[model samples]
Target: MSKRKAMPSGGSTAVPTTGKRAARPSFEKPRGFFGLSDRATTWILAAVLAVWAGALRLYKLGHVKTLIFDEVYYVRDAYTLLREGHERAWAKDISKAAFERGDIDSYLPDPQYVVHPPVGKWVIALGEWALGADNPWGWRISVAVLGTLGVLLLFFTVRRLLQNTALAFLAGYLLSIDGVHLTHSRTSLLDLILGFFCLLAFYFLLRDRDHFRDALGRNEGTGEGFGHVTGVRWWRIAAGISLGLACGVKWSGIYFLAVFGIMTVLWDWTARKRYGDPRWKLRGFALDAIPAFFAMVGSAFVTYVLSWSGWFASQGGYFRNWAAKNAHASNPVSEALLSLWHYHEEMYSFHVGLDSTHTYAAKPWLWLLQLRPTSFYYESYTYGEAGCEVEKCSAAITNIGNPLIWWFGTFALLVTLIVAIAKRNGTAAAILSGLIAGYLPWFQYLDRTIFQFYSVVFEPWLIMAIVFVFALMLGGHAASRTRKRIALLAIASLVVTMTLMSIFWWPLWTAQVIPYDLWRAHMWFDSWI
Candidate 1:
């Protein structure tokens, strides 16, 4: 008879696994809820936070009544896109009055020469289609929904990447409270929609990275050919599509697409070297880099082209038949494609030459400092005029971020840079990628008229950087209990300060009719006014 192996001590018959890495603490994975898994509990907590975020985003959404700032352009564009098949010119100064009076037919016959793409307007049209376009709620509902969902996306992304529920909650909570994000989410503009896609692409890229690394670790020694045959990375493909959608929203997203594409190839190269491949560069270029380029950039091109389906279908779309008229192409497909190319050239020229002065234009360098926040709406009222309880009152909607959060976040980025360079933390580097993609490109456009509200696109990355610093402060398992408590207290204090500042600035962000003194209190800088 075969000899039976003796069991371990303590009356246990469990077999120990060899060569497995130790996981993080069980604190991130709490016990099941009502016999359900820990995942359900996590989702429940995220939902609770999301509900609060949704409430804030949805509350008084219709209170603004009139379209503010760029909404004047987008709201009508959205309505026209739905009513007509394509965007049409509208009476800019007088059409808003007609629209507010419930005259929904404000658009004229000619297609408008718009600079931006149609995907963002299509998103707004979804809201307008759901509810009639005559109301403020219809114009702003989709942005509110996306803004709320973005918080959940950030939470899950952090939780999935780092496996830290506390850090996930902190990132999402900070984003939810940030005034710039809140303001942009409420407004019917392209930037927030653009931000949502960029954030989604980031989440997918993280998933692809995790999957790739895990596969690389598992199959490193076994592969004899050009690296381990990890199958098509669907997450990476999804990221490409999301980035494409982002480009359709605003051309600024192309920076992210290019940067992330390069970053992913670098990730693959480093991963191969880390997994014991000496000649990683050659193998990675042929095996990983080529495939990743097709996966991301190729897919982005297809998705961006598809976003112009409406314009393609419209016979009278701006320059839709320019090839037929100007080029006289015999091939139908070539004609359409050439016409689209010519249209893009015009749009490119418009963006490059956009030097018209505006009251709220700000330099990209000052965006991070919150030096000159764009005021979307502002109106003063004497007592008894428009819900004025004081002798002088003000109603305003400003896209200024929380000062403490912005200033502290700026400092946190410095910390991130140190960690990225010294500690070689990939996560820190990824956070920097978003900021670089969103903020750096604007400097080239110093002559172009841009507004501070565009900072909303990178606000999530700022919050992520802040969370990374906070995570560092909370020391590793080797830390003493006293040290942990002190670190927690400090982090708690900063969060409380951020929350209170958000409270103080809430009225200014939401266009609430308030006393002039209260409004003046919010303008910490003379430039803000």
Candidate 2:
């Protein structure tokens, strides 16, 4: 064989060598406690935002000084739940005037048929127990605290999900000041508690997603599937408990429980495939899906049953003796269980058959647009009355959303749905998933009398969708610095505008005295009245 010519030093026949830049590593998953980075900054910002939100909620919380709207039912029930183990019947046509003047003897001595479960009342009872039940501050304090904590929770959750501190703070701020959220926070109500628990459950599930992903990645290329992933999955169990608590507050939380359970299993399937398991589908089913049912669904069922402990432990609770009086009677435990099931059946029927008309009743489709805002409390004063200095003054607590946030956020939701489908983006898809869990279920009850405030349950998700749109505007790391700065400025302007809107609507949100015409100006739609 002929010998080949020797190549020159530092040069080859293949080509002249040229310097090439090393590729940067994939985006580093920031590390610290619970997947949060910039620990001091993140926590500091969170605490400040939480305090600000709490102050806004707590300000004038007792100034209304009386039960407003459903506060009559929930607040009174909360007090009775503390004193009596169950809600007692109220005198028919009870006088509100008497009840607000420290006359709480309106309840009759029999068990009242309550539509909602006891957990929400239990939470409210904490405040009533701590403070005096006769005080409005006591009635509303628990929900206000929950609402503030929800703002903080959203901040931490978004920060963990996107790993962006500024964006997370903005998300928290928007939710903190939004009109509907603010109003709910200031009032003694169950929906805010329901929203709080649902968001918490979602946060826990998000944490679990990462935990499972990291575990599976550690076992990369192992055909062992879930055998290596087995453990307590405490975060998932926590999510289940949160979901159950949410359901205890309202039946609507069942939608979140169902949707999140499905989403988690899908995540596991993707994780198995990414980890190089060719038999991912079957293995994921055998390992993840089956176990998840027990982990999430089973845990939720157990927790939900446990939440009714107060009702179960009490002999005089409504329907506690239904099974004893009927065919399902057995032992006391079995009778109580059966009676609870029967009570649930009755509640389901009542909810499904309800078609009562109300001034504030709104369709689900119109909720995104805020067409029919519910007036939780409204009072008109003549000039000098109630601290009013105008020709006509008004004090109101309306469940209207921040128009700037809701209207513009509607577009953001559309973008999220489109981006989710077009890019097959997991994060965008997850955002839409929460929105669906919160809002779409109401469409099934179009014939029922649902109010606009019910949208509070999913308001956090809507804010997340809006933030996702802002992320799209900010562009990727490869985008020019100038482009990114412009995007940031544009997003900042919108946020500032939302803040200004929050101020303009703050009087109505807090039931502060404002000119009648000003209140009218805030009510852009005739239906808002």
Candidate 3:
């Protein structure tokens, strides 16, 4: 396999433009730790991170023993979809009590009016099929699996970008211990699964950037529109498919699809200009942007439509035959299409008009600031009840992020934005794209009842931003031994501190029973309760 030179982590250092070649800085197969080769150390770190994240997510998987928060809707929908290929409504007078008693078949035969698409629930159903549907194991195992793999994905992504294994591992470690991610991973929810696909798409696009630039470099001799067409971009297609799956999970995925598609074209445009394409502006749009639009957007559209195969195949799904009842069509296929369009319109209306009052509802502005996090589950008990040795005990699952990590990441995010604008660093711009794409769109709906948990979609990018600063502080490969040591110590201290924060907050994050005072200590703001 051909190795593309990794871009520098953005800072005050002299960075390269899109096409300019920088000094190598000497990082091909650096010495490994623990008497192992560099390759062996890298894989070992990956394995260790996977195990650590998996243990955190999978430990006491069914300890809660009850469906909390959104699990009530999604876990039920998954079971129904597993059995009937469509969501069935819950029976009247049936609550979680029966569900916890191994009574998974508590749903009526009538189809339910679910707003979101079915792909996420189908993913949930896979675990349900493997384990019993009535238990927490069945409901949560799939998300745990995705959450674990997401840590590894972030590690490999940073490794590929910065080409520094230690710094890459640092990014992965930060993600694994984040509170919002941990809560979503242990519970049955669509958002984290949505996040996984979005990050996966980002990784693919990063790979495409390398391949497209390589093709451009190879064609420096030909000098015709920067080498034919750079051929077909398989990585871009894979990215589109991953993003389509994200849309299948939630409508929020559309923002990512549009933004990432544009970002890729800009990367190509920059490469053209850097290579001295005289008519780069017009040629970029004509040659690169148009094909990219079709390649990414068209593929995403097709994949999204195909994701509804389960709905189309079923006769009893909600509004399945709306066209037949209301509008006339020439054929069944056209009728199905019309019905699907109508269903989408109704879903759109519901989303726009939803203004439900809830204690934990927060504006998008407070998400990264950690002002008000949603509570997934909370239960209090007096003495002599449920392992309560103290006067009162609390078992809660709070979706607040790790404080020190987020504050540092927020700083990193600002620094990256400044570097991108002032230096026009492509690396900073690309890193910032994921955070902006995931986060900024929500601001349009300031009045909408959203939760901080949605921030999971871009949390990996936030960590990437954090790692970018760490790379800069560590200096380039040419830095002195003492300088590198100080930077490494600073990074190591942050990791150790964040790990301790996770430990302090884990009981509240996971629904473990703890003293009321301890739980209250974890709550720094009244709004957090």
Candidate 4:
């Protein structure tokens, strides 16, 4: 074969140039829509997640026909909102008939003034509206749906973080089996809504990271030392909104907004450095980080205020007109808004100083081990009453987590902290930060009467931390097949253990009619009972 004419000494060779390959597609986009491609494997995993989350959230959803725990508060508040334009007080017996015959008018017309924001109550109202007034299922259905969505969001979030389908599924599976999550899902509670929003904010921030990095990689000008990209990331904006909604659900969510916002900015700074930018640190802060802070935190503030729409509109809400009556008045509307804010300040003060004794109060340090899970509902039943099967039976629903998951997961978090400090792994650091955002702040209130069940807000992130460490243990994709097998077996064992523990705890968490002896049998520790 005639070799291509060697034109000159420095001429291009025509021997097909096989040694130097064509530029490979960027590692940034690894298949699928937002990496979710039409691969059979992806579809199969999606189907599996759908079934897992659905089964956990939907099975025996109405087992406890009566209100359970916090459901009594949220369900009633929701019904009142549906009838009156604001929350109203209800008679003690109203819960018995409020669901029947649409008699929600048992509530007073004046605003009853609630501590939590109304968005969660509105969410609860959706189920009540759909199923009508008298159905317990109606009140709980929305929370169940939101809790299930949290699972799926968690799956996607972990999938993005770990870049492994198996690890993502492990996180989702652990969350599904968590007894606290199960109880919260079965009841109408604001914390579950807060949890869902927190997870969503995390998911959106992940999306923002991926998109921002992809944008940097694609911009040829960036290679020439561009200072910063001014692109408006819709994903980051959505994350801001979600973080705000989380805060609206509970003030604790502000911690997430603050931490994740900082986390995203740091991630951008690092991405810039990794791409060989010279002034990455300064430019990342001045251009990328500050704007991101505004988008996330500022937007969250606005969203949180918006959640008080009813309080703003109604004249009878507590403190709604305080500013008007006091010297703080500027204008009627402005005064009313200021008064509402003053009310929040007072509430915050109360929350911070709450050192009163409570039967189920727990220190933040003991929360990880569930040393004092709150008993949401408890009743001792006599034979032939309340479905008692023996001489004396018990029906209870405790907001406790699966012991295997919580204990092992907390232990895994300790390992993750060590690894992050020693190895400086970015993923490990990120997972730890999320857990801290949800948990560590509670330590500031150790003297306050915070219950262990409040840990539910951050429980999903704890599970994520566990899976993240497990992913690290599994080694990289190039690891030996034997190592991968061992990792899989270990993870499978953890899951199996968690599932069994969940089964044992299910009756107590759901108030099923079980013999008092059986209930006691499930209570592995005196603290748990």
What's the TM-score of every candidate structure? 0.92, 0.92, 0.93, 0.89
Q: Please write out the lDDT profile of model 1 over residues 259-304, one tens digit for every residue.
A: 8998888777655554445566898899888999999999999999
Per-residue accuracy of model 2 over 95-180 as CA lDDT, tens digit each: 35545777776677888898998889999999988887778988889999999999999998887767677778889999999998
lDDT by residue (1-529, candidate 4, tens digit) is: 3322321111111222232321212332224445456365556766787788777777777776766666778888888777665677776766556645556567755556577777889889999899875777788899888888777878778877766666777788788878888888878888889888888888888888878766676664434444555478788889999988988788889999889988888888766655545566788988888899888888888898888787777777777778877789777777977897898988788778778998888888888998888888888988999778689999888888888888988888888888777766667777877787888998887678888877888887798888877876787656899998998888788788778888888788777888999988877788876
The residue pairs found clashing in candidate 4 are 32-36, 32-37, 33-36, 99-133, 99-134, 100-134
Q: Count the backbone clashes (under 3 Å) in each candidate.
A: 0, 0, 0, 6
Q: Which residue pairs collide, candidate 3?
A: none
Error of 4 at 498 (Å): 2.1
Which one wins by lDDT: 3 or 4? Answer: 3
TM-score winner between 1 and 4, please give it.
1
Candidate 2: C-alpha lDDT: 0.82
Considering summed lDDT, which 10 consecutive residues are worst modelled in model 3? Answer: 7-16
Off by over 4 Å in 2: 1-27, 30-37, 93-95, 221-226
Give the per-residue lDDT digits (tens) of candidate 3, residues 1-529: 3334444332222324445443223324345788888789989999999999999999998999988998989998888898888888997567566578888787888889998998899999999999879788988999999999999999989887777788889899999999989988999999999999999999998899778766766666654545465778899999999999899999999999988998898887766665556666788898888888888888888999998888899999898899999866779999999999999999999998888887888888788778899999999999988899999999999999999888889999999898788877777887888877899999888777788889999999999999988987987778999999999898889889999999999998888888999999988888888
- Runs in model 1 deviating more than 4 A are 1-37, 220-228
| Residue 120 displacement (Å), model 2 | 1.1
